[model samples]
Target: MADSAPDRYVLLLVPSAIRCQCRCVVSHRAGRTDSRLAARCAAVASVGAAVIHFAMSPTHWNDWMPSGVFFAAIAAFQLVWGLLAWWRANGLLLVAGVAANVGSAALWVMSRTVGAPFGPHAGEPEAVEAAGISVLLLQCYVVMGAGWALYRRCRAEEVSAIGRSLVLLGATSIMAVAVTVGLASGLQGHHHGVEAEAGHGPTTDEHLGDHHDEEPTAPGEGAGAQTFDHHSESSVVPGIVVVQPPAAPAAPPAPDDGGHQHDHHD
Candidate 1:
């Protein structure tokens, strides 16, 4: 009876132990899957940001060489990093990804708000454009995904309210469109506003042409010429005036002229 009782107890504990082990295994697999998904999300976002940077690099090159080179370097780094992350994610890669994206995003915000600290266009606040905003959004997703992958506790909630991959695809499309528009518009800093200002203020040659198209107030009037109109007998032109003498007071008006016709012939 004692042996049977001990046997029964051992059997009961064995099943319980098996169930616990199964649960642990399932939990671990679930965590691994979630991390993989997070890594994929980060990779997609990073690549999207890289595309935007690549698209903008040429335009920035036109504005400033250093800026263009910086953008190109960033794009290349992000592209390689994203590819690596997608293949296999580790703690170091996740941390580096987060740091790079955050720093870039912060720089963008600073340039937009307080203006760039150094450059030919220094001290000039860059206007917020669709492309810039799109990049910011992508970087935000990259940071979130990287953070989630780095910490398992974040897997408690869905990384995205919608499907993560779907959301990333949509965001990537939006960024592509924004970058196209930004390139078409020629960015915001020296392209839009400065060009518009130049357009509004015509050149000296244009001013001369405009003046030529209009009729002048008087003859010999080119610029800075002022003329006054006087009686029909005399003319006042710009810097010169002409006046007719009184004709010796009209010969005293011919002494009332009614007595007789006194004519003077000359």
Candidate 2:
């Protein structure tokens, strides 16, 4: 009977090996699908963030912070999903990915406010601001691309769709940067012009006032000089009167004398 027990143990080992191989194959297939789902979910989260950033103006951090946190959470979820996928639970990974994306979308919606903190003038043309936003948008694209690549490695489907999505996101991000930079530049120019005009305006007013005062002083000085001239001339000719009427008086006296002589001769 002891010899027979050894034979039975060998028979059991054969069956165990066959079962192990079957389990391995199943696990590998499940892992492949799970990894693909995780990657796709991550890509969707990244694309959503980009859209939120673009559509909103004066994007505020108060609301944006939650979205950022949501992004981090999605990444964590994807890691877990990848692990589950490795363990042959593809369904769990799919569920987790979908849940994460939903959370991300909700966060984006909550962040939308009626007015932007920067008062519609945020993200204007200072090179540093434009450059910072551009870098941020680029990072989003990079993360999405990385996720898509990983997904393709796992699933091997829809290569064209992945490429197209990447291209579209990149182009949109570039256009957004261009528009932001242009607006900022225009605002800066307007501000500078207003400052310059304000600075020069006071100086012009001051100069004009000085000229006006000088003009009044000139007229005052002329009037004083004229008074002095008139006073001097009047003092020089105070009571002088010149007349030449003596010749007329002498003709009147000769007429009276001739009339008396003619009366005596008649």
Candidate 3:
């Protein structure tokens, strides 16, 4: 009877043990799945930021050499990092990403609000434009995803493959819209800047044409030309004409003065 009791207990506990093991396996898988999704989302965000930086680098370079170089370097680093995360994201990489993205986003906010602390444009606040806003949004997403992965919160439930795909699709759509609108806004801004710079001064031909269209001043009307008459010689310039007064008759000879002195001597 004692042997039978032990056997019965062993049989009864087997199912519980099995259930516990299965739950552990499932929980572990769910955690892994959640972490993977976070990493992937972060990777996508990083790649999107890289694309925007790449597109803006040239324009920024045209405005300022340092800004262009900075953008280019950021683009390259983010691209490489994003690819690495996509391939295999580890804790160290996730931490690094979160740190970098947070710093970058902070700097962006500062630039838009107060101004950049250094560089040629120091203390000059930049406008909040579409490209910049898009980049900010992507950076924010990157930070959130990387932080989520690092913390491992909300990992109790398993997300299905379809759900992951939908998430990715939504993210991609947001990035695409941002990139498109941002690029368009940037191009328009550049075009307007060029036009404004060009419009600062009028061309010589246009200025001359404007003056030439005016009616000519009467010859003797102005104080400068009061001595001038209808017969006076004229000088011509591109858009102006000046009349020169005739010379006075040579002083009637001092010859008369020499004759008056000889009469006084007599």
Candidate 4:
């Protein structure tokens, strides 16, 4: 009878043991999932950081370039997007991230065309070459891909409301960039005009003074006559010898009378 009682006791504990095992398995799986999500978020943030750095490459992380402002704008979006992605602000992150990618692509295209994109007088090969076409295109894919992935997995409540509100910021930034280019071009023109005037002032005066000094000598014909003599002098002499014309034939007797008189005397 004691053996039977022990069997009953084990039977009573079996359910609890099974439940504990199930709970442990569930917890372990949950932990793994959380880790994966965290890792993905970190990766997303890292990509955002890369985008920010690449955008600033033209300006060398400074403001020397006109495109630096556009890059600054992109970096700002990247910062916000990274934070949102980390916090699982899926909606706002998606909204902002896609826009950022579009804007960045546009910026690259602008760089290839004119200095107007970077700033006034920035010119080609300098600002455009700041980031290679392949590298920038790759970045565009990364941003868009990450943003899309986050949006797909993110729940409705994951992103803050602010993200949704600021989604259009990307569009607004482009217009602001255009305005900046115009203003910078104008300023550059004004500055160049001032510099040109300053630079020419002294040079023009010096040139005028030099002309006045040479005025009296300008009409001299000696230079022209000498140039003509030099060209024809070579044709007259192969070496240094000057050829003389043969002596003219002796002149005929001037008068026959004088000749006859000389003959009679002989």
Residue range 1-266, candidate 3, lDDT tens digits:
77899899999999999988876875567534776778788888899899988888898898789988998998898888899888787788988888888888899888877778887677767777788888889888888888887776334357788988988788788878877877777666532111134346888999877655545566555554322233434633343334445555554434564466232211
lDDT of all predictions? 0.72, 0.42, 0.75, 0.46
Better of 2 and 4 by lDDT: 4
Model 3: lDDT of residue 177:
85
Per-residue lDDT of 1-266 in model 4, one digit per residue for the tens?
Answer: 76899899999999999988866664444323332243244335434444544444454434455445555655566666655555554444555666666766665566556533334445542333323343354445445555555544422123334543343243234324433443343223222111234343567878766554432322433442222123255565333333333465654645665456232211
Candidate 2 residues 1-266, lDDT tens each?
77999899999999999888866664455423433443443444344334434333233323355533544555455445434433333444444545554554443233232222243333332223342343244344434534444554434433345664565465555546644664453234222111234343567778766554432233324333322232244454434332222342222324564466333211
TM-score of 2: 0.25
Screening candidate 4 with a backbone cut-off below 3 angstroms (N, C-alpha, C), the clashing residue pairs are 66-118, 67-118, 89-159
The C-alpha TM-scores of every prediction are 0.57, 0.25, 0.61, 0.35
Query: Number of the top candidate by TM-score?
Result: 3
Q: Model 2 scores what on Cα lDDT?
A: 0.42
Candidate 3: which pairs clash?
Answer: none
Deviating ranges (above 4 Å) for candidate 3? 1-32, 153-156, 189-266
Model 4 stretches astray by more than 4 angstroms:
1-66, 113-118, 122-130, 154-266
lDDT, residue 211, candidate 2: 50
- Arrange candidates, best TM-score first: 3, 1, 4, 2
lDDT accuracy of residue 196 in candidate 3: 32
Error of 2 at 238 (Å): 69
lDDT of 3 at 150: 72
